[model samples]
Target: MLFSLITMAIVGKLLHNKGYEIEKLIPFVLIAGLVAYFIPIGAIIIWPFKVLFGIIGGILGFVGGIFGSTIGGIGGITGGVVGGIGGLIGGVLSVVFGIIGVILGIIGIAIGLAFGLVGLVLGLVFLFFIPATILFVVIKVLHSETKIAPDRR
Candidate 1:
């Protein structure tokens, strides 16, 4: 299960980077991961590796963004990369928070852990990684606005 979740996360992310934008599938992946975590189907220790990879990906993206910005006349190049990193962060955060939320939620049910539930939901949203979708849309709008549209007349 752990292996599958990790693979799905990586593959989905790659697809997203390649313009597929498969944000809708994140929640399913995350819920699967959470269930797998409890069922002991995967190495719980592997969780840290997720965070590590996310950090590495983010750093690589930041460097890429730097180069892109320098080469491009405007921030157009970097913004997408930065936004992609942001989306990656969101995915990573979802995994991290989901793990925490599940653990605490199960343990805190008796105590009514609203915080845990809230965190879990927020994590779900992040895991879906919707920000990149929105960011790209915004970037497109801005890019179009900056362009001198040919007059219809």
Candidate 2:
């Protein structure tokens, strides 16, 4: 556990320095570590729950980081307000759709690509696009503010 935490911290810092944000990685890493630690301590019955929780935490962390970055990039109160509203909507949609799809899969109402499709949609909408949008927006804002053109070299 200690080693995991230390590793997470170091990796988090490295990612941050490489243009990734802490908010996006910390929750997922912590949840993953906790799940790993608990599997050895708990019985098999608890593993599934731990895994599910870890997934949920990762999703939430990803969305939250995107929302934060979006708000941070806009550079004013109006941007913050808009970002907050958008984040709230996005978060709700992501959670609802993700849970529904997972439930459907477990209940056998969905199969194969059908199950994966929902998950993929949920992931793309909440996980990938949100973070990429925020990162792009932030980089552009920073570039504009510093008057330093993005390096091509």
Best by TM-score: 1
Candidate 2: misplaced stretches above 4 Å?
A: 1-41, 76-153
Give, for candidate 1, the lowest lDDT window spanning 10 residues.
Answer: 35-44
lDDT of 1 by residue, 61-85 (tens): 9999888878884566578888999
lDDT of 2: 0.79
Clash count for candidate 2 is 0
Clashing pairs in 2: none
User: Which model scores highest in lDDT?
Assistant: 2
The segments of candidate 1 whose C-alpha lies over 4 angstroms from its true place after superposition are: 1-74, 110-153
Query: In terms of TM-score, how similar is model 1 to the real structure?
Result: 0.24
Instruction: Looking at model 2, report the run of 10 residues with the lowest lDDT sum.
Output: 36-45
For model 2, residues 16-114, the per-residue Cα lDDT tens digits are 788877678778667766765665544466889989999999999999999998887766778789889999999999999999988988777557778
The CA lDDT at 127 in model 1 is 71
lDDT of each: 0.76, 0.79
